[model samples]
Target: MSAYRGVRIADFTQGVAGPMACMLLGDFEAEIVKVEPPGGDRLKDHPGYSAWNRNKTVVTLDLSVPADLAQAKDLARAADIAVFDHPPGDLEALGLDAASLRDGAPHLIHVWMPPYGTCGRWSRMPPRHSLLAAISGIAFRQGAHGDSPIHLILPIGWYGQAVMAAGAMGAALYERGASGQGQAVTVSGLHGVSEVGGVVMVLDQPRLPRGAPQGASPSYRLYQCGDGEWFFLATLFMPFFRKAIDALGLGAHWEVLVLNPALALDVLEEVFRSQPRRHWLGLLADAGVPCAPVGNRTDWFAGDAVRHAGLRLEFDDPVRGPLAMPGPPARLSATPASVRSLPTAGPLPAWGPPQPRTIGPGASRPLEGVRVLDMGSVIAGALAGAVLANLGAEVIKIESPEGDPFRSDGGPFLTCNRGKRGLGIDLKQPGAKEMFFDLVRQSDVVLDNYRFGVRKRLGVDYEALRQINPRIISCSVNAYGDAGPRAPLPGFDPLLQAEGGMMAAQGGDAEPVLHTIAVNDVATAGVVAFGIISALNARRRTGEGQEVITSLLAQSLTFQLGEVVTWEGRPPAPSGGIDCVGLSPAHRYYECQDGWLAVAAETVAEAEALLTVLGTQADPTDALTAPPEGPLAGRLAATLAGRPRAAALDALEAAGVPCAPCVRGYEAYDDPWLAENDVFVAWRHPRLGEAVGVRSYADFDRTPGGFRHPVPDAGEHTRQVLAEFGLAPERIEALLAAGAVFEPAAARSHLRDGGAALFTQ
Candidate 1:
């Protein structure tokens, strides 16, 4: 049985963020009932909905109707946790909000995901994924130059933020078990993007005019291979740089370039262009510089390493015969992650009456009521602990005596540490080591992201922790792997971004660029979290736990391995510019009188059909045809540009081409197709008024449905949580007096208004 075999989740989510939280929960064996409105979730019509909405039970509710709203409340009351997305005040307006649900079910765990946070200036803004990407500067950052405005291929910022929400919800679930009371977790896509992009934001201060570019050094950059493919080479450290140069037989130019980075990059680029990618890759691998090939989605799943690692999962789906999906990334020697089955489509299956299980105080739960001591400096380890906590693990966060550096004056720290108990432990203090070991004895996992050996110096290393709890899972995250020479170097998301060639890839040939969202950090967090879960699963079978480790540098390197390997042996080539038209003449976007439409012709037959609509030659190979010099390129561009976007789209689709209009973020809310599919729902908010939200990507057939609360206020459950933890009034006061814990002052005002209470315990 899965560790979370009996857990129940009431998912009241719309769109990717809240649904992803539930998706992770379902993966761990939670009984998740996804609640939707009578129309259903908006994601059912989304391009990628099938991939995200799986392994879930779906139910429909009409919150605007009093009878249906009452039923939703009852469902929440019976659930262990509820996940939802709403603006600041929607929950209160619905009367099925967090406070009401918690009042009915004191032990319920509530998760709320929103764009921006519930309290921010943009909290009430009706922004979709792309809009969030635009507002957070992610879209703008991907422009050719720093000041330009070019959107990226996808809404990566929102995706990363969604994962953060998933981790936060998990942590909150774990905490609810400890105190026997539910707490509210509020997550914001904007804040999540901001946190990931914090380094760039900080460096952009007026005083630091030359704010750090995504690439601070040339060692981390991309080079064009002989086959016209892109290869990412990340040799950030001097030794790796030396090795790469030596492997490439560029010794003569090395000394001059090494001393002057600008000169070195120029020389290396010239040398790299001299050969095709494969030739250089073989040479570089033998010499030891971390490298990879830049690959498209198709190349990603087909790559050798991915297949060898078993990262692609094929499952039987009721709607689609053989569905192929990305497998869980983390690997364990014992109990590895596996794909159960593809998600079912349509309505959810019916579950029988609720079966509630009760446990007295101190009785162990699955994970044997394990405790996790989180000491990670940033979000990665903190998020991992949160995942474990969702599975009934108790995670205690040990912050610096001064406070967590990530607090960013309370925003980030509060967001990441929602469900975990917080204690200020000054490891630098004289007796702090003893207190730590005592805590370790009670913990099943000790997680941190400090520089590789820093824990040993602090006396909290795996060996030391094992002395206290022999079966403890000690997991460490770093910029690079723990034992490599570069392991000692200080690094973070941005640094890894540069070193892993993400910046170069994002920049293309223009200049290094940093994504507004921290892709490396969030992706690494997911990888690490998977590692921790896999290790825990192993312990169940082996009667032992072991160390699970990961690094931003390693994850980043692996992420680009496909492209990097492709660039080896190839010398650099001059820019021939993007062949956007060549990518797909039939598959390209066409402008009509109304708007733009994206047409995809994946097959030769489809390509021919699209060409017929354009009244052009119906040849699939037409895309490969080159334009005559001068006015020909301009003429074709004008012809396509002159067409009405809608008419062109209609003609193309009528001919059996896969086509859809490119709807901007805000416009997506009003799309008829999406509305027909029940992708967007309008809910009234008490404070923010009316709001429209997206639905989860996955849809299950057997569970209760929908989100339970709107976004929560900061530290929204302090007093109630403390009381549940069995702390006497005096003790609570004492701790408050010592500055050991705190609750937001606004929580009191909300309580008086019968608003949801916010707290940090």
Candidate 2:
């Protein structure tokens, strides 16, 4: 929405994460002045630069020059938010750090995003996504089981960082509206790992359920048809999987299929291969199974589905000419976000700070007084609520009487549902709708991931809820956008991954490879969170709330923002081959004698240093100008093949090239670098006992948040919450007796066993 209307920002950042973060705000009508250096951003030529710098005013200044530095400081002091990404201590010398600028403009929201953090063991490392991914176990997570790590072509973590920063900015603004003061916000590239990897990257015993590198499970993986075309079957939930079996005439094999997934894998593979893609897809679609044909980004760009859903944007650029790329991440029904204009070079516009907002007293957290009802199940919808919970909203996750099937999915459930209380009710029962509307009357937001019309049928759609609470916000997540032909189809992460070209891109020239990171699911959570908060910000100003919407389909394009664009004279979008080493020899993973080493040498100087370390005769400046399918890549690989991993990293680091060992996500728990930064959070769960996950990604100087509650058991807080909401004890008991409300036997056992220790660390 135009929730950020009238907001002004001084964007003193470059590269993927920082620029994308600022651009997301600009999408909603925020006025941004991008202050570039005399030579412009180091990534100015990168494909995504055009998309990331849209809807902003661009100006160039040399911070080393006194006159230019003063102009930059003036712009920062005059803005509502000042955002920058620099190595630790680099900005203080220029008098642009938070303390320096905030001294003169106490109302400016200062944000700094270092590669690691403002202060940490790896803070000074070059802000390279490859190095961050390697050191933080992202590379290892992308690798196939029993395979060497594959360097990622998609900078998913950086995108995660961008969305997290955008949300944190909204949180800060919401808080400032109350206190009439601004504060410093920090969201590091490393913090992005927490946003995307929180589910699988754990430091606990009994690791989360994992799938083969190809897919999550037999029913939820990619398959090749007889015509050689591939499609992803995404029946992650059992009901759909069972439907798929019955539709396939395999009902007789259902017992074995349910009990022995390994055997079922073989049967399903043969069954899918027996027919052409269209034939199987037709049957599956008729049976209401979720699946999509594997496609590439180039084709996806031309798809009718995207155009129909309005997820594609067309803009004319002075340099790139006519360009087409992805639209904003979320859709706001009332105050919709739009692409106003492309960034153009200009001097800073004359500006002054506006009158400060004077609202009611602020709380300890940005969303402290906000209340939310999370009716979403599984990852995308549930994780959105968890994000709001971390932002200090009181979130209650509503489940059916039998509870969310995903609750048994272990770490994934804990990851998405943490910091929220649980309530269980059967809406079909006599008094359930009355009880639900009571909670809706008091809540500010309601979230769900049901298919397009399911909410309307369930009597919880936006129209139904708005009638009950005029100020209520409704957030809906789905596989596709709200009004597309596919909007009514059931879908999941891999379905979008297949249709949006992620699988083809990641797989390169080989068969489609499904990323195990749950890229679409994780990213949708953050985006949905931002949309909900953006609506909240709008409500604060206009005294009304509206619909907030996002889908995995939108995020699929967003995750590959750089590659999802096309324009005249634009270079080919970079795609890694099956090797997954990298886009070029200078910036990729190299196998060493002991382990893998990742090197990031994109610039001429860094490329020269890398060549020198490898004793290569290749011209440094032109080394990466061509694809790495030449002798240069071969030589670089040959040189590192003889050396040990640690030695290669040492040589590269000493030569001023960024590098890190490809450490497994699980092994990162023992790394002293991350430990020194205190990046992990440990909490207890009623069912799973002690567990550790990545901490909250964004940091607010005046209002920090961390683990405040454990994962809730089904209906765990139903009685307490109902009583607190003014329901009498007898009424609650009567509802429970009438089967309108429920607490499972396991939850009752937990209470009897003194589960007070569940929320403790």
Candidate 3:
């Protein structure tokens, strides 16, 4: 059985964030019914929809219309939890505010995916992936200083937010089972990205010179091999480097180069250039230096390692033939995630009428009765919990008395917080801490991403809560690890890009640059969420839950460890920049009138093929002996200046030389081959209209997968939520008057059968 088989979700979402949350749930076998506007969710056409929107069903209703609103309320009423995206005030207008929803469905798990959230100054400010990246400082950090507009690394930043949102939803679902009462969980992408970039933000003493190359260390740099292929070498530790040197028979040079690191690098580069990449790879493997050839998208899918890892899966789709899709990264021994089927094309999948039930007998799901409380302030926390919720855990989101901060970040929030419940609680109130503790006592996990020590001051610290429930698993995520020197510093993704080595490494030898995508945030969230799930699995066997902690700083540093560990204790070296054209006759990027193609050959046979293509034969030994200096580069540049890109690529490919067009950003979206592979899907939306693009990253077999909803308006579930929480009409009035809660105007007309009266408690 899947981990989340039979799990039920009340999906209130639109956009990427919340839908992503539900997607994870769907992947694990949770029954997720996406509630949408009478028109539909907006992201049906988001680039790569086929990859993102998988394993789910969809339904639409005009929440602004009274009858539809009532139906939405009924849906929430019948669900174990409901997830939504909206600021606090908007909930009242939408008729699906947290107070109303929780009042009606006390046992529901609520998740709110939003932008700046409900309370902060920027809470209501509109946002998108670009705006978030720009405001967080990531945009400024990407690319060469004077290069094209700063944009994120294609789709990666948005996907990061989606992953975090999914994890948060999962956690909330896990917590709901024990509390017997739903709670509100929230996540923000801006904050999530910030946490992921924490390490660079926390540096007490800057070590490297500003604008230095990221891989300045000799042990962790890319080199061109004899056959023209590029390969990375990362011997991060001195011991590793020593091993490599000995294995390469360069011990005498290494001993003599103790005084100058540049000399060492030059010698090493020369030695590496002596052999083809493949030959060096074999030797390096025996030497224990971690290295890999720079791979393109085509290479990634076809590579042996990726294939062996089962990172790619094939599924049959009605519209497309066998579809190739990426698969989830985490692998469990017993209850693994599966891809049953590709997402169906057209309007959202038709969902059956709502049904209510306490429990059903079946083979156990991984998180059969786990309960979670998610109070994530940003993307990382939200996504971490969402993954758990999807695996059959009951998760409840605890919003601030004001509301979640992400309510204003636009579609991202809706995309991240689908399929859970929401509850607003004023932690500052006299009894609020007590209420929180009560909820914690009933929950198996409590997930948060507040700055270090915030939970302690707020009386939600794990030490204090463990006394109330020793088996409670607490996961705290932050920008920096708890004990680091910069642990207390606040950070966002862009700042981390400058601080972490990513920005420097990504832009080649240009200015230190950041990836347009929020890699740090997304990667950290994934790692942290994975850690939390692992802990939960261990707890199952031990009946003892422990704390799982991670930080953006730790994750980013881990990702860049190849550079960090190698550069540690080593002084920077003056750049020994490679003369690509001069280094090898067959290594070059040829420019056609319309485009460019990179061609590489690393063996004598391959070189011979290149010579045949060029219709020239110089002495092999003489060509190899040419000085790697200016004249060679100039001559090569002239030789391949105006060849047609396609023809050149075809010739190289036919000759067994590796060659490909270097595509960036939107151009990748237009690639017909990608379309042929069914990597993108088309979906119709009510508000933003039609969208056609890439889907989720991976594919699963044996379960539902694909886009189901557009991004949702804020608090789309207010009225129905309150009704399910059992709020009485008169009492709800008093609470609203007391400023305890609200629902959006759109949702207000949907209240049915005097269900608004249960919120007085």
Whole-model lDDT values for every prediction? 0.53, 0.82, 0.51
CA deviation > 4 Å runs, candidate 3: 37-40, 86-90, 115-127, 140-150, 200-216, 226-228, 253-275, 344-761
Tens digits of lDDT, candidate 2, 1-761? 37999999999999888999999889999999999988999889888888899998999999999999998999998899999999888988888988999996778899987766556545787777778888777777773654666777788888889988999899899888888888899888877777877552234445433335567578888899999999988887677989899999999989988899889989999998899999999999899888899998878877887877798888877676888878898999888998877777887788976665654565688778888999987788988888888888899988886666566535666778888998888889999999999998999999999988999999999999999998999999988878868888777888878888888888887888887777898889999989988888888898888999889888988888988878877787667666476777788888899878888787899999999989988888666665665678888889999998877777888888877787766677767777776777766676656677777878888878665778888888889889878999999999998878887652332212111111111
* Candidate 3 lDDT over residue span 1-761, tens digit each: 55566667767777666666566666667777777675666655442345445676666777778888887877775676577766547777866766677664665555566643335423443334443443333333333223222333332344455555565454444433333344555555543442332111101222212111224446655566888766656554456678778888887777676457689878878987889989998897766555555433333344443354454566655544555655554443335566665554334333444344353233133355666777874455765554444444555666664445444222234334433466555566455566567667777888888888898998887788888888887888876556535466454443344444454444335333334344555565565565565556445445666776666655443333212322113333111122122134554444555664444444567666766665655544433444423454345445555677677667766776554554332343354543443444554444445544334322222111233343233344434444544656675465445444444432222211110010000
- What TM-scores do the predictions have? 0.58, 0.94, 0.49
The parts of candidate 2 lying over 4 Å away from their true place are 143-146, 200-204, 208-210, 356-361, 616-635, 746-761
RMSD of 2: 3.8
lDDT of 1 by residue, 1-761 (tens): 44355668878877666675566556656777888887777655442444455567777888998988887877777777777787878988987677777774656667677754455333454445434543443333332323222334334545555565555454444443444555665556754553343221111112112212323346655676666655656664556778788777777778777779788767777877878878877787667677765543334445543454344566655554555555443433334334464444345434444444353353233233566777765566665554444344566666663344344322233334433664554566454566456556666778898877898898887778777887888888876656545566555565455444555555455444544344666567655655675566546546676777667754553333223322223222111112121123543444445554455465677767765666565346654233212233343345656788767756765777665555433344465544543444554333334444433212222111222232223333445545654657886566555544455542221111010011000
Residue 44 lDDT, candidate 3, scale 0-100? 58
> What CA root-mean-square deviation does each model show from the true structure?
13.1, 3.8, 20.2
Candidate number with the higher lDDT (1 or 3): 1
How many residue pairs clash per model?
66, 0, 169
State which candidate, 1 or 2, has the greater lDDT: 2
